[model samples]
Each structure stands twice: as structure tokens, then as C-alpha cells.
Target: MDLGIDRQALVPVVQQIISAVAQWIRNSGASPGTRLPSIRQVALDNLLSQSSVIEAFERMVAQGLLVSKHGSGFVVAQPSVLHEGQWYEGAEREWGAFVDNPMGELKLGCGWLPDAWRESDDISYAIREVTRTDTAGLFNYSTPLGLLALREQLLKRLSQIHIATHLDRILTTAGASHAQDLLIRTLLKAGDCVVVETPGYGNLYRQLAFHGVQLLQVPRTQGGPDLSALEALLQRHRPKCLFINSLYHNPTGTSLNRTVAERLLELAHRENFLIIEEDVFGDLQHASCTRLSALPHDDRVIYVASFSKTLSSALRVGFLSASTVIIAQLASLKTLTGFGTSRFAEAVVTTLLANGTYRKWVQRLRKRLRTQMAATLQVLEDEEWEVFAKPAGGMFLWARPGVGDRSRVQACARRLGVLLSPGALFSPTGEPSDWLRINVAYAADQRALALFRAMGPARSTSTILKTTSV
Candidate 1:
């Protein structure tokens, strides 16, 4: 194979070699499982040092593009089979249907909790200590209203974010999504209008639709949800609730500005509708304003947030803050639903809050996430991949490929051994986009970056995606 390498090029000899080899593989119509020459043979053919070829091969192997065998040599790697888009097969199965295969550790599409984040010894310690001290509450079923001490702690946090919610009005649920469901159940009836951001979180929308709510699509701009369109929908449909993620909105990684937030609250007041702001990504906000809730004022904003995003995902702890009246209604709805939040989880979280470890951990996490995000962005930019908005504090970057079929690109990424969350997963109809949401937390080092660069671009389109404005 002719590599067409420029020995004088400044792109580093090893990188050039890898790029040439990769381009050749794509153009040659060679299927995966094809084997290449040995390092010594390649070195001889290219008239280069053996170490250069070895380095290139090593890099390819790490990126999942090539696999190495002990006695034989390196061969093309197997293609990854990650599911993309939202297509529920049955009541139990949903988007990205993940079936655990026999090759246990070989997963590429989902964002997993790295070992560093899963060290839950500290969590264990906190839970044990709290259960010991609060023995009485530990044994009984948790109050539907949530533990008083935990509510007080949550209120203190709400206060820090400029949300002046009372302790009595707060209700803790299994997680942010749980809080979302309870609010939806309480406010929306079947066929009621619910405005959602286009290309928003698919599962949240799916949950709302499953409850028989009529969905109205509001186009999202970089500054946040398109207020003009939202106003039109509010007047046209007279919807029951506006489901928004005003800060660090999912998939797009966009947030609303203070001006827009005020205008949104004004519209809600005039329209006489409620706002259910999913606050899963609120902790990643770079702004100074409080997150928009179902009751921003006059008891119209219901604020939902969870520790799953900021802390461990296994700790499914989420809460909602609103007026006493709404809280009472939600509390009634919660009872008819599943059993209340876990006593153990709440007690453990409460313990973490009391000892101040949660705050410390959050600070450390933010710092690490920020660094990792920058590194991921730099790697993408280096390869000239088209990126959407520059998120202030979110953990993901929405990227579009320069050229190729989105599905094919995804297929290629799997074959290359790099797992990517395809853009179509966020959409309701499962329509493919030339975009992908990259989790910065996954690739935090040089090895990860190198793998990213070797994977190439996603499916390119004539109309490119712009960054969401904040």
C-alpha cells in the first residue's frame, strides 16, 4: 500500500504514518478483520525506523482500530454495535437498548462511571455514620415529605442558588427524573399541551408522552429556548405546562440568559401556566442566575434537581422545591405512585451534607470536569471537527462531523473502538443527525485524546449545527 507520506511535513512522522494508513484502509475497501504487515516489514518498505511503525501500530491498537495477538500480529478490530436513537420495543425497553453481551467489559456507547468516581467508600462511611446516629428514622419508611433535616440542608443549598424555597415545600424523590414524573403527573392531564425544546432529552419527553401529554415543539437557539415561538405556542395551544431545562439544557448544552429568564417568567404569569424546569444539569451552569423552575414566582415554577449528575449515578437522590400548596398536591400524587424515596439513600446524602464532604467533592468534581472538557474540545478542534456551543460548565460537547453518513460514522466509530453517543438519541423520532454529544468525563488523558483524533469525523451535512447561545 502506498502511504503518500511527506517526510518533510511538520505533522510528526508517527501521526502522518497513522493518518496515511487509516486513509488507505478506508479507500482500499478492505473490510474489518484484514491484517496488515509486521512492523519490521512496514519499516523496510517505508525505509523508516522500526520504532516509528511500532508506535503507529500501538496507537491504532489503543484506539480500538486494530487488535494485537501474542504469536501472530495486529489485525483490523471488530466494529462496535452501539444502539442509537429513541425506539422503544416494548414497555420495558427504550432508546439505546443495551443488552449485556458475554464480552462483559467491551462497551462503547454509554457513559460509564469511571473507577475513580465509583470509589464509594466515603459514601459507605457517611451512610453508616448517619444510620448509627439517626437510628429511629432509618428503620421506618421515609416520610412522603422527606426527612426534615435533609430538607433543611437542601433549602440551604437552594438559598445559595438564589431560590428562596421553604423547607416544608420541598419533596425529595428517587432522582431528578423522578421529580419530573411526579410534577408531570400532578400538573398535566391526558391531551394537555406540553412545550419541549427540540432535540432535548429524549427520555424526559418520552416519559411525558407516555403519560398522554400532547407535545409542542419549541425550537432552541443558542441564547436558549426560542421565546418568540414559545409565546406563539402558549397563545395557540394554551398548553398546561412548559417543560424546560433553562440552564445547561441537555443535548444542546445551552442555557438561557437572565433577560430571557425574566421574559419567560413574565410569559408564564400572563399565560397562567406552570413551568417544570428539569434541573439535572444546573450544577454545570456558568451563570449567576437561579435556574428556572415550575414555580419561579407566584408558585408557578417547580424546581427539580438531583445528586446523580453531580455525584454517583447509583445514588438516585432528587428533590423538588415549590410552594406549600403545590407541594401538598404533589405529595398526594407521590403516595399513589411508587413508594417514597429510599431511607438509606436520603440518610447517606444527609450525612454527606452535614459533614461538609459533599461540598468538597462537588468542588473537586467541577475542577476535574472543567479540565477534562477543555482537553476534549482541544482534541476535536485539533482535528477540525465542527463543534456546537461552548458550554460554560456542562459535561458534554455537541459535535458534528465534517463529512460522512452519521450512521456509518457511528458504525465506523464502533469499529474504530471508540464509543460515541450519536446525535439522533436526543430526538424523539430517532432521525439521524450529523452530530454527536461527547462526554468529556470519559476521555481525560493523552491516550484518550489520541484515540479521539484517530477516529476521524462524523457524518457531515450541508446545513451545519450552530452552538447554542446563552
Candidate 2:
């Protein structure tokens, strides 16, 4: 109730009061559940009208920093601004929810590749083939360096992806996610600064934040990252690593062109930081032009990709190709962490590769994805949604909700049993946005159309008005 405001400045009286009260609660060592001052009492103490105090409290509640009880007035809801600082623990909670009842609900929330898109069939055939040929190796634990044959296959694929790596430079993990985790554990220390793209993949964001690495963000551009902003950040922070999704960048679906790729590589070289390229969606691109890759046979690039989107996410076959120095460190880290990827799965992947079925599977899946992407795009375009249509390849369509409150859009999607990923989840502060990241690989069903209908108006009038005024 002791909150005070200065009327001399341009800032409104209510905002000053709100900030003062918020800071007081923060500094007072009060628990999150501690009740805040009553609106009337706050108004009286600050010599402000009751309406102003009420509006201030309402704004705080809307921001999720405060919670109001029907009988008790407002209380601090989230006392700590830990969304950015401790995102991994939060991500763990979210994943826990996913696992709790995965198929029970229409889980459009997480960007999971459809079950039919997985390599279960290909994997099954490989397993059978491997069992028929050699059952002994399948049952045993893989070498710390991974199966030699699987490593060879991985190296060959890396060469096709513009990274010329030897078996010695490739290491296997349980999944691409595992590779990323191991890399962070091996190379980065707590509090090390890591730069990621704004509106980036939340899992990576969570993992980096969870490990206590300071995250710096550069805005995503039409073709790649905002280079000027990235350079400015490079000048200011000099981060330890730069994590990028160069080919079909996540959430935004913007691929890096050759020019953008060269600039990014140049920055990484000058900054003395490694580039962690997560190209999980590289195989899904339908375009004839090959997407750009950070691995230019450079030791500074740690290339990582998975079968998560291309094949079966459950197959958990992810490879890392880097310089001998990093590959050695990451291998050691993998040994200490999960030992190695599944031996049976590696044997299966090897068998499939040897048989040439893996390529056929990718061709079929890519064709289907291209068709689905078109259908998805048609539906969205029919709805007048704004998206980057030139994304050469990827499952997702990065879109802005055009003037609508993203939270409202999310809520509407939920009500229609079609969940969407709100753009705020991609930001450091979980700030609200008009953008939404959507996975188009999932068949565009009537349910999805219904969900869009729930969005009410297409453009947010307020947002358009604000822009006009600006």
C-alpha cells in the first residue's frame, strides 16, 4: 500500500504505481502467494483514483506477473522472471505432460512428425535382416565410437550434406537431441554465452538455458538470420557458440541462402565460436536446389541432424560431424552420458542403408510431404494467413497471426482440438507475439480448418491501427 508515483514524467501515474509495487514485492522477500495491497488501499496510499489502481492491477494480472483471488486482491503469481533463465526445467515439465497421456489427446501442441512418417517399417526390415545375418552384434553394446558400419554410413551422408567427414570425425548418439546435449556438456560451461535465433526451437532454447548458458538471440530474416543484428551481438557479447538451424530453420521455415551462409560462417570464424548446425529437417525439403549448410569442411562447424522428422523420431539415430578435436571430446562426453546410441537401431540403419531402401523411403516421404505442404499452404492461403511461402524445404510454416493476440489464437486452437505453438514460447522472456509456428506435415483435416475459423477475425484491428498510427 506504500507504493508511490511521480507525476512529473510522461509515464502515466498507473504505470509508475504498478512498477513501484512490483519492485517492492520483489525486494521485500515476500513469497509468491503473498497478497498484494487492495485496490482501494493502493489508490488511497498513492492519492490516485480507485479506477487507475484497478486498471493497473488488471494489467499486471494480464501479464501473468500477478494473480487475483476473488476474495483476497492480487498476489505475486510468478515472483521470479525465470522463463529465460531456467527454461530446461520448464521444458521438462512440458515434456512430462506430453508423456503422461501422449495419444489420449489430439496433441498438435508439440511439433511431432506423424506416426506414419517414422522409419518403423524400414527399421523393422533392417532388424529382421540383421537378425538373419548376425544376432551376436545386435545383442551387444555398441563401441564407444558407435558401430563402425553405422559410422561409415553417417560419414557418407555427411559428405552428401556438404560436410566431408571421416568415420573418425563422426560419432553417434541416441538422437540428435542427445548429440546436442552431449555437445553442450562437453564444450560449454555454466554461464557461457550462446547465441541462438529469435523465435527458434524451444527445446534447444530450453536445453541451453537449463544448462545455465546465457542465451543471446538474433532475429530471423526472410533468407536467414538478421546479419546486422547478429554482428552487433557478436561485437557486444562474443558468445561461446552460435546455434543455428541453417537448412529449413525451425519455427520460421526460412532457409539460409549461400550468401547468408557465407556471412554466418565468416562471423563464426571471426568470433572464435563454433557453429552448432541442427538440420533435423534437412531431408524434408522438396526443392531441387540444395539448402545451404554451415559445414564447409571447416573444423568450426559441428553438424548435427536426425531421422526424427525424415523417418521415425523413435529410431533415435542422430549423428555429429565435427573436427577431430570436437568429435573426440563429444565421443568422450557421449560415453559418460548415455554410453552410445542403440546398437540394434544402428544395425538396422546400417542394414537399410546397405539395401538402398533408406533412399527409397526418403523419396516416398519427401513426395508425400511436398504434397501435404501444398495442401497445407492452400488451406492457409485460402484463410489469408501470412507465411514465408518460399521456404525451399521443411515441414513447418512460420506465420504471423496478423494482428490477433497469439494467446487468443492458441486458446482458440485448443478449444477446437487443434493446438498451435504460440510465438512467445520461442522468446527469452516468453513475451507475447502475433506469430505462430505450425507444422504442415500433419494432414490438413477439417478439424484444422475449424480451428482457424475459431480465430474469428483474420487481422487484429488494434495491431493494424497501431501500425498506421506509428
Candidate 1, which ten residues in sequence have the lowest lDDT sum? 461-470
Per-candidate Cα lDDT values, in order, are: 0.69, 0.70
Model 2 regions more than 4 Å off: 1-90, 97-104, 288-297, 456-470
lDDT of 2 by residue, 1-470 (tens): 66535454333566556556655665576777889877877788778899988888887676565798988888887645424233434444445444553223344446666665565766777778888887866678888888899888877776665566688888888778888998898899898999888878888877887799999988888777889999999878878888888777778777777778887778878788888888887776566433334336257777888876676666688787777888888877777766666888888778887788888888887787677777777766666777764466567777654434543464344333444555666776566567777777653655566555444355465643322220
Q: Could you give candidate 1's per-residue lDDT for residues 226-251 as a string of tens digits?
A: 88889888777888778787776677
Compared with the true structure, the alpha-carbon lDDT of candidate 2 equals 0.70
Q: Model 2 residue 335 lDDT?
A: 76
State the TM-score for model 1: 0.75
Q: What is the lDDT of residue 339 in candidate 2?
A: 67
